[model samples]
Target: MVDANVMKKTFTVPEIKPLDQYDFNRAKVCASVRWLLAKSYGSAENVPADLREPVLIGQELQAGVSVLLLSPDLYWRAHSQLHLRGVSQGPGQGPGGVSKGPGQGPGGVSQGVVQGGDHVALLQLLASRGHAPRDQDRPVTVEDLQHTPIKTRAHLALIDALMSLAAMETVGRVKMAAEAEQIGGGSPWENALLFWVNRLNQRLRESTEDDDDKTQTCTDLQPAQPAIRYRKDKVQSKLTPTFPLVSGVKDLSNGCAIAAVLHYYCPSRLPLEDVCLKDTMSVADSLYNLQLIRTFCCGTLQGCCPLAVEDLLYAPPTLHMPLGC
Candidate 1:
């Protein structure tokens, strides 16, 4: 960073703000993108030395990011320090220290295996950056780059890490960073309810009409929901609507809504198999689902602001904005 010099015709360009869309012309064609990364991470010194270099928009960023992801620590650190914004302390040196130096993959193994904690951190960071792998069930092992068992996990994670970086580069910052207030008097719950209802109506084969504040299965409805059009023997079959009707705010007490919404937004974080469309029968059931939602939001969905089970269950007016957004 240097002072603007009228003598040299060089002008001061502000650092690309987080969540704000990057100005391609100034960011790439003119200004060094290294300044943006440095500023984002706090200072040039705070930025990890490994990734401290000028980068253009395309191949340069991709190549640099891929090389960084091979070790896990650098790429995770870059996003954590540069993007997570107090969400996490980046990837920690888990059970084993991360791999360092070139040609240090499988051969230099002793301290390179990514442990369970690191694996979770990587996934959370990646998923939060909207770069989670499509294949969610598969686990990242202690031997990601350390050992090659049929397939290399490094390449798989590389794609995620690279795309995650790209997303961080392009994602738009939230509107009105200076001051945030609910636009209308208060309509977050109603707006969220309408948005979900309308969106699900379009995508889902059919949705339960959640007209009342009652916990009831699809069968319990006064009139059965519509069946899907597809058929096995030219005869239409009734598709059981996994997502039940959400009448009022309390209807989301079960972790079902969180799973469904987050799954829809970021499917890699919460797979379709994990979403339970059923309503909670008891407090234990609600808590179990709520815990899952909390982990998903706080860990997997790293970008989203953390919300507690009480906040979610109680359906407070304060949460209307978060829910709607």
Candidate 2:
């Protein structure tokens, strides 16, 4: 077991600079971090550096969003509150007191208002949970923003701005792709995707080889149950481990790049315009592991893993399309 003190010692908190000091782009990212820290730590100022550093890296806004998405505690809390507020508000008081039905916002204007409302609601919720500054009556400044509701609101707005920018960038790329020659096979997006995919596959292969070596070394210590041993050996031999369809892209930019590539080369593959490739990858990875576990468990019980009815309706598909094509 690891020592708690050693673990604590290993953790370092990154410096949370004044929000004003960060240009608009960075401040937006920091805002998401602040919101997360505020949820977990009660005060954004109290957020540990170790947790803050990763979100601060490339595509901070997306990183921050990913953090929230992965953490049920944070995601549900914010989402629940947002949902409650949306339902409680009167018809005329639609996000920011601007009257608009669901999906009827004035393009960009209502988006900004809705985001502003979300930030305020989040900060208010945090404040109720004792995360807000005690000196609520005091004049708000950049430093004060860290522990104040205003800071939370600003951070929320920043998050919205960052998302809008990302959407615009994606649209611009799609438009460019339509007008330009097929991004030659050597485009940067394709190269990056290829690099990450190859790296993942290579690592997987290495890990499998290591596992096989370990299994051989541990053969002498095998359990006395012949049935168990046979099942384990059979499962190991029969399992054809292939990379899951959506396992390669790790970050938002890479996910978007992959999506763009898909849209450019095989448009039918994308079912949604605003498809979150990262989320899809996450789901695919989960399903792949679950299927493997189910197969192993059922095999041990002398039963077969049952495929879903939908899966049986179609022919078994390849893990993914060839990268070279």
Candidate 3:
């Protein structure tokens, strides 16, 4: 059972500051993206010595790989309200529904609506910045992405890694949801729920495989088979269940990271997949606490500042110290 104390704690929005205040934060993110791109597509001299050989060799073998980047506008609009201050209810919760409280069930992995959208925006902005010398001034488009080939093997490897991450997240969410329901019903070990959840996941995987098979068959029969058309609205409505909007920031981060990494390495392939959720409460909590520390430090010193990247990547030391020390 979820602790009542945990459920009672409110999740406040991070304070809004002027865009200039976040310059360091934004620059750090952009720099990481630039580094990843350089490693993936740059010439041997441009790439770090350690990565030069692999990147150059990979370029020759991974020529025709493609990725599709889907627009996140629908997702952004879906969870726009979650960013507002003092809004306690989680995204998509109806009246009197179970609110996703701090430390309640798998809240640690819950997606932050604002952060996810921010990542999407960052990717789009970076993609607009062109890759090659001749194409650097030209604007990137969906058409450009569809036809472009991935230049580096590392970039393709990263995409595969992200797919694995996304699959893990999908499985985690399904298991978490099932566990929450089981706990809510006063039986933590319900065999039926466990079996049902497993069955559902298996079906989803089978459906994806079936779709791939059908697509391959359709490609072979394209010349003789007439195109089937449906109203846009009807198609979208049918797809709504399969493509949920409440995706976690980690997944969004993965997409943005992939896009930024591939923009220069493989402009032709945009990463695309069905949208899914991620639990990000733990990361959010860490950020919130870090900001609080920064606030205190700034108050003590006139302008206490540190590299945002260090703060982001820092991990708390796990030490076994004596109490007296």
Candidate 4:
């Protein structure tokens, strides 16, 4: 089924514009990129018709991949509160033994030797997660992403790929909380989420304390309150999701919960005047809330990944976040 909500998320109220095709309108793309650049130090570099600035885009993609790779593991470790990767062989040779060469001196323990290019790493990440690109599709090179704007349904597919990846890690713990059941939850779908949540919330506490935010965790459900609506609808908006229970997935979907979380940690990123705690059924309002959340993630949070507005709007259902991480 075609989702009509594509390209709708914006800082302002979403207008539900009809798409001529799948790609983002150049005007919108240019505007957002320019805004991203403007925030950086030095004069904002205007993105010309040729989106020729490859370095930043490449770096950003690499950064996003790294964030995705690391956060789930961090969540897990925080939940466990112990070094789960402890070697059965003990410290034996120790963690990193410098390679001693016969002819020369020690090859001083190889520090920070991260392999794989960002392009390959991103594709591999997607492939590993079952979001592999199609064989019929042409490969997207730096040239294609930077110099040549896509001209078919490719852009839409690409956006789907990104949206598939961006839901968790960067935006806030809220998205992770929503999908908590999937990440730390066991294989084939099951509590890893709550386990992770308890850990993360604890890690976030004043001290390196325990994750005790049960009411807010996904495992436990909250009640029908005017503060949160089950769904973004007009007629049935007030209805309680799952009646007896509602996880963070539905309760925090509008992005308001994320805003509240950000305000506590990074007040400067989201001003109090900008935050609206009340439940909002408007698509634009929801996207704006997510925009604010994404802004905080990409800017204030350390090691936080970046995601497109489309990604925030169309986040995929949570899945196992690769235990082999």
Q: How many backbone clashes can be found in candidate 1?
A: 3
| Candidates ranked by lDDT | 1, 4, 2, 3
Residue 314, model 3, lDDT: 37
Report the C-alpha lDDT of model 4 over 162-246, residue by residue, as the tens digit.
Answer: 3333322222234444454544423312243333434443433322122123224454355433222222322233322111111
Stretch of 10 with least lDDT, candidate 4: 74-83
Q: Write the per-residue lDDT of candidate 1 for residues 1-325, one digit (tens) a residue.
A: 0111211232222222332443322222112224334433434455566565444453234345345344545434333333333243223321123333443332122243222335555566556655554424554443554342322334344333443343333222423221212222323334334335434523542333342223344675464433432223232323343564554445566666656666667766765444334332344445555656766755754324223455455444434323332
Q: Mind giving the per-residue lDDT tens digits that candidate 3 earns over 1-325?
A: 0111232244232443343443432333223222232322321134334432221232232112122122222223222311222323456332112234444321111442122333234234233322111133443333343333532222322222222222233334444445434323222222223333335434444554565445455355543321222233222112211211212122212122212222223323321121111222343433343343334334532212222322232321100000000
Task: Give stretches of model 3 more than 4 Å off.
Answer: 1-20, 24-29, 41-284, 288-325
- Candidate 1 local lDDT, residue 24: 29
Total clashing pairs for each candidate: 3, 2, 12, 6
lDDT of 2 by residue, 210-283 (tens): 65555554467853221111222112222323322323322212233333333334444432122222223333
TM-scores of the candidates in the order shown: 0.31, 0.21, 0.17, 0.35
lDDT value for model 4? 0.34
Candidate 4's error at 125, in angstroms? 16
lDDT for each of the candidates?
Answer: 0.41, 0.33, 0.28, 0.34
User: Lowest summed-lDDT stretch of 10 residues in model 1?
Assistant: 1-10
